[model samples]
Target: MNTNTIEREIAIEAPVERVWSLITQAEHLGTWFGDAGANIDLRPGGALEVRWDGHTLIGTVDAVEPTSRFTFRWHQLDTPAGADLTEQNSTLVEFTLTSEGDTTHVRLVESGFGSLALPAEQQVAMHADHSGGWPVELGHLKDHAAVVAA
Candidate 1:
């Protein structure tokens, strides 16, 4: 892999505190991001596991800075078949919340793509997969927050 990273950002029409609460809440996550029953322990070094449908994603909380920033380490099962594959990846997903007056800028910066347990080609493909995935997730987050704020 070329050690390249994928990043996506979205401006939410909500305050930093509102955005932060949505991301940290496991029940809200399930309603918008993953399976409806997913559970999250929002503490550093805690378990972050989500069992969505038949796919399971398990990770650990790496960093948490109140309603400002949070990072995690993840391992996901399953992907688009024949695109690329890795059993585990020591990747970093960071959520940075910055407020401009009333709106909050939510930036999702995911790095360490080359640390995945797969061939260089596969790692690159996985990066591509996430490159698209994060935007959709953020869109969902934005809409969810807007509804809650309303």
Candidate 2:
């Protein structure tokens, strides 16, 4: 596993289409990703904003292949609201879904930490924080998917 990237996978007891809808739709994103809310355009190069605890993280869609892949880039460090989020200041997040029988495998990858223009310590801390966060977030997603499937 690359130190600059965080990767995680979860097997959800749901169909590919159901898992895709939970991951891509703005309303469903709020439950598993951002508790406050989310607003997404749902297309390549579309805008995505996830709100949590009064802060909104802005992102840009990179890919949207239904039930297969979804990718985006978002700022990894704290920046002023409305700041332009470019690759230089952001990290790439990718989600790939695969269907296995009755279950859907969801894989998440977040990379580009080494390129951020931040102190080395802060970069390490940020990486560690996200490393610990993905599993918890994926757990929430898995739980939600199970509930919805029930």
Candidate 3:
């Protein structure tokens, strides 16, 4: 496939700490990320679970650098419930925050699609789905951040 990683960035008109809370905390994350709800243990190696639509996605926290960087690894494709999520079946999702005066610049990258243990066409389709999803997701995040800041 021609794609393996999806990177998107947005400048939120909010302080770094405010942006960080929205991204790392479970409550705010559900509003912008999972629609249904989220339960994230915000620390390195902690468990991250997000429920969207009718499915629950499980992930492991890869890094949490408070107000700066947060990352996790999770299966990007639909697998049967109870499927073991490991590096062999998952992609890494990273969120980075940088302060620009009063605004926070948020960058998100989801990579490792080429390593998934799935059919080639399925891998390509998964990558394309996320590529289209990030802009809409980030736009929601930006709007949510604005409302929270107001």
Candidate 4:
């Protein structure tokens, strides 16, 4: 019913400070996020590129709040680089981290699928693709954090 968004929450067995660095730092993000790699500016209005299966998804950072939150807007699957990102062509991704004693509670939400100007089939497919992928990626983050904490 909520094809417009995908949400995943994960608990990383690490402090908020460490998890914040893992998420915001480009080197860590590249390994856990995309196969080819990623380059993130990590500031508001900065550029973001995460390569997945040979496709480089372009995005712009919208917010950064140290260990608390990070947000961005990125174009969908098959979108070409250098293409302008309009509201109908991109989705907003928000990462919210809540400190829980020595652990970090991470909640990720990606929305805007219903507004995409893509064909109905493509929209549904992309929504489905991300629906399945976010949990796995969050799992990766959790595992990676565990390693780093170890």
Candidate 5:
């Protein structure tokens, strides 16, 4: 497996339309995304910051595919203790949502960190860390969407 890639997939109990709307809308994002350093401009070329606890995750939106997909350039602005990560740009995030009957399939891919601002070792480590981390984040999305749909 390529450590430089961050991929996560989850199935939500909401319809494709509902899931799409929740994920794409800035207001809905702020509601369920729990402010995890998350700041959504909701437009192309806008900024995104995902914060949890006290740390911050920063990124820029690269593209938005209406109700289908979204792409962004992602970086870790601060470490666990709010320490700045010297190696930035080791990440990029893309989200794809598909509707299948009453279920929505969400796929998240974050890559491009292999050649970012981080040292080679740290970059690889970050990639590995994100590999599992993304799924957990998606789980949050899944639960949030489920509740809203109900």
Candidate 6:
């Protein structure tokens, strides 16, 4: 079985531009994502940080395609907040967007669980945690969009 990736899709009532802003902008990310705060540089090679419950997750932008796609490499769940992200210690997250009339489609993908250097049990647990977490985060994003776009 392929347990290396988690994928989620959500349709938002906001335009593509607004959805893109909500995901890429630090202000919106913190609200829909980390409870403490989030900050992003929003360009390839830029830094992304999300803080929640005293734990920080650091990421580096891997690609930026404006309102269409944003990709980043994030530290694994068990890794220390500020540790350097390596292939064995991080996973790839990609966000893709498409505009549909008055709404926007957001597709999220996080991969690399099978290749992580962590123990097999740890890898399985991380995959399960993320599989469940992404949906909630996307829901927050959709709700946040309604509030922001109103």
User: In terms of TM-score, which candidate is strongest?
Assistant: 6
lDDT of 1 by residue, 15-77 (tens): 888888888788777756775556778888877766666766667788999989988877643
Candidate 3 lDDT: 0.88
lDDT winner, 2 or 6? 6
Clashing pairs in 4: none
Estimated TM-score for each candidate:
0.85, 0.92, 0.91, 0.92, 0.80, 0.93
The global C-alpha lDDT for each of the candidates, from Candidate 1 onward, is 0.76, 0.88, 0.88, 0.87, 0.70, 0.90
Candidate 6 residue-wise lDDT, 67-127, digit = tens: 9999999987567656777889899999999999879999999999988998888888989
Candidate 2 residue spans exceeding 4 A from truth = 80-82
Clashing pairs in 1: none
- State the lDDT of candidate 3 residue by residue for 54-121, as single tens digits: 97778888999999999999876567776767756899999999999999999999998888878878
Looking at model 3, the pairs that clash are none
User: What is the full ranking by lDDT, best candidate first?
Assistant: 6, 2, 3, 4, 1, 5
Expressed as tens digits, the lDDT of each residue in 78-140 for candidate 5 is 444433323253356788988888888888887776766667788778778777677766777
Which regions of candidate 4 are displaced past 4 Å? 77-80
Measured by TM-score, how close is model 6 to the native structure?
0.93
Candidate 6, position 22, lDDT: 91
Candidates sorted on TM-score, descending:
6, 2, 4, 3, 1, 5
Give the clash count for model 6.
0
Measured by TM-score, how close is model 2 to the native structure? Answer: 0.92
The model with the greater TM-score, 2 or 5, is: 2
Which residue pairs collide, candidate 5?
Answer: 36-50, 36-51, 37-49, 37-50, 37-51, 38-51, 90-113
RMSD of each: 5.0, 1.6, 1.9, 1.6, 4.2, 1.7
lDDT (Cα) of model 6: 0.90
Best by lDDT: 6
TM-score: model 1 vs. ground truth: 0.85
Q: For candidate 2, give the lDDT.
A: 0.88
Residue 123, candidate 3: C-alpha displacement in angstroms: 0.9
